[model samples]
Each structure stands twice: as C-alpha cells, then as structure tokens.
Target: MSTTTSPSKHLLELQGVHTHIGAYHILHGVDLVVPRGELTLLLGRNGAGKTTTLRTIMGLWQASQGSLRFDGRDISRLHTPQIAGLNIAYVPENMGIFADLTVKENMLLAARQARTVAQIDEARLQWIFGLFPAVQKFWNHPAGKLSGGQKQMLAVSRAIVEPRQLLIIDEPSKGLAPVMINNMIDAFAQLKASGVTILLVEQNIHFAKRLGDSVAVMDNGRVVHAGRMAELAADEALQRSLLGLAL
Candidate 1:
C-alpha cells in the first residue's frame, strides 16, 4: 500500500454521507474524497452501493446526512443541474447517448452548451478516434448502429466533449469484447494524462487493475478498503474477500 498524506488537498469531499434509495437505506455514513487532478476508482461486488454513491456526489440523490463539497464549496443541497453546471460530468452505465444521433451531431449539441468545449472538442475527438479508431471511421454513423463497446466509447467521448473538472463514469466496460475493453483502458489512461479527474465505478477487476491509480472497495454500502491500485492487485486475499474473485 502507498503511504498516506492528509486529505486536505482534495477537490471533492464527502463526509459521513447517508443516502436512502426509496425505502431502502443504502449508504451507512459513507465517507469519500476525490483529490484534485487524480483518478479514483470505486470498486466492489454487486449491491455494494457504488452507483448510489456516484449519484449522491452528482446530487441526483441527496444525502440524508453529511455534506458534499466541491472545490471548497458546500454542494450537499445543490440540484443535479447545478452540480453539472459546475463542470462535473457523469456518464451512467446506460451510456445515455441518443441512439438516433450521429457522432457529429452529438458533438455539435455538446459544443453548443459549452464554448470552451472547442479545445476539448478538438482534443477529445482526436484522442478518442486514436483510442478507438473505429469512431473516426464512423464519424457520421448513427450511434444506434454501433456495437456495445463502440457505444460505450461514444458515451465517454460525449462526456469528454466539454472538458469538465471531474468525470464520474459507471461500468464503461459492461458487456464489451476483450479487444474493446483493452482499448477502453488505453483511452482512460490518455484522459488522465490530459488532466481529467475521474471517479469510476467498475466491477471488472482486471479492467480496474489496468486503469486505476487508486482503488476504494465498498461492501454493503460502506467503504471497507482503499489504497494504491498496485496494492490491491498484489493482495490476493483482499481480492477474494472483498470482490469474491478467484485470485
């Protein structure tokens, strides 16, 4: 495990977050922080409540207790659009792309909402095309015509069009072919290098192992383990116990 410093340098802080989904209580005083300019992975088995945590951070679900702060501002009571206006982009597991829209059309719409997006628009499209060349090859193609992995890439690329301060992505690799999965990892690494703060929720341990810088493991709605991704990879016991993987 890597050595720890204090969390005072964090850009996003969630202190003792308590959230409920419908009648079900999910988060039990959850605490998390996303340091500025760093990639953080949220990992766990199914039903561990990682999705809810992301929603809470995005203000989709308000915490019954605790506070969420972004860049030293209290946002626990902010609306979803308010948080989004702050440049925190979220790509849900569904990819959320309009299937009928073409890649060019999607980028066009995104560009209209964000003017500075031009830089990211130029950089992100080029980078994504490089990461998954299929995108460039199919620029005018409708999103619905693409495969699962291609759709996933488009979703991420769509989010990156605006160059947000933070990106929270859920299950970017769900139902993807092995080749596409590898390609996605490379793309994520490129985004990190380009200065994107990422909070990713992933179930595929191998994918997380390849892309994650730091890993936080959640179980039963609470974080139970956190450390450098290297440490998580080396500890077979931790993997088997926390993730039920046959390490």
Candidate 2:
C-alpha cells in the first residue's frame, strides 16, 4: 500500500515530528498544517523550535521521528534539493542572497529554466518588479549594496522567480522600518491573492494578524495553538497565553 495520504486541504502537514541536532533535541512532536492557498503564520517566542521545524521540512535537519507530508506525499526522507525540486521555495531568515552578485545575477540564478536575462519570463519579472521597485532600480548594483528591506525584497523575488507551489519564509519583516514593513505587507497580500500557499515564521504580531489566514503558535517545541488568525487576533487573553503579548 502507498504511504502517501489521500488529497486533503492541507498542502503541508507535520505530525508528531521530532528533530535532533547532534544530541540536542529541537522539535518535540511538532504538529503543523499549512492549508492550501492560504497564508499560515508560525508564531512563537525565541528558541521555540520554529526555525527547526522549517529546517526539518526543508530536509536541512533530519527528523528523528514522525512524518512530513507535502501534497499528500511523504517527504520525510527526501534530500534538500529534492524537496526544493517539488516547486517549494524557502527563504531563510538571513535572506540567502548572494552579496557578491548583482541584483539581476541573483534573480537569474534562482530561475532554473533561464540561462540568460533575456530568457527569463518578461511578464513574471515585470510583476516582481511591480511588487518591489528597488529590485529594478538596483538591477545592476551588487546585492550587498542594497538596504536591508531591499535585500529582503530581492530574497522573496528570487524565490518567486519561477512559479512555486509553496513559499516558506522566515521573518520577512524583521528589522524593517514601519514604512518598509507596510510595503512588505502589501506585497505579500498581492502574492496571496495570486494563489500561492505561504508558510511564514513571523515575529511581528501586527504583520501576522493582517496577512495570516491560518495561525499556529509554537511553544517549547510543540504547537500550542492552531486555528484561524482572526480568532487569535481577537482574543487578547489567548494571545497573551500563547505569545506572551497581545496582538
């Protein structure tokens, strides 16, 4: 019999997942679900295993126990490149841009099918430029010269250089000014509207509340809360209990 589950609403699901990094346990039975075509927010305090969960999903860290399912297929044993080949894009917290490369070079590298700038899909490139003008403005400039927020935009732009089934991002708004955060929020909103499932590890409650359709809160290496983002946003007590602060 096949190990893969039947099709369901969730694009990604982690059940009883446990991960260890060289004798140190990071995730303890973390259960998370990213519903198809919705933005899911993974929220928690520091050292709450959020990053570990993302890494495990990407196969950067192996799971000691349990299963990871993506699109009804078991991906628990897949390699990182194999996982990425399934049209899932991951943008790490550090933004993962090549500082030495020009902005255009960074984007070209992400487009697996394109060998040159002229080969890249013009419409898609234009759409990305619309989402982040700085990308176009600094196309010839080295990625290292861009501002923090610009770099974050470039990272996300690179992730969507080609179409993707899911986008996994870690803290897109971290260290961004309020104006840049708002811009990022708007870009994400458009991305969501265009029908891409997103699983984001976010520290900004306001950003989470605004963009998240589903929310999962991790605590002590496990999911303590899972439900609609509106419910979590409206409940101050629950917010305090799960996140230690009001949203």
| Full-model lDDT for every candidate | 0.83, 0.96
Clashes of each: 0, 0
Q: Candidate 1 — which residues are off by over 4 angstroms?
A: 1-8, 112-124
lDDT (tens digit, per residue) of candidate 2 on 57-83: 999999999999999999999999999
lDDT of 1 at 78: 97
Clashes of 2: 0
Best by lDDT: 2
Residue pairs with backbone overlap in model 1: none
List RMSD in Å for every model shown. Answer: 4.6, 2.4
**For candidate 2, what is the lDDT?**
0.96
Question: In terms of TM-score, how similar is model 1 to the real structure?
Answer: 0.90
Please write out the lDDT profile of model 1 over residues 149-230, one tens digit for every residue.
Answer: 8888888877877678899999998999888898888888888888888899987777888878877889998888878888
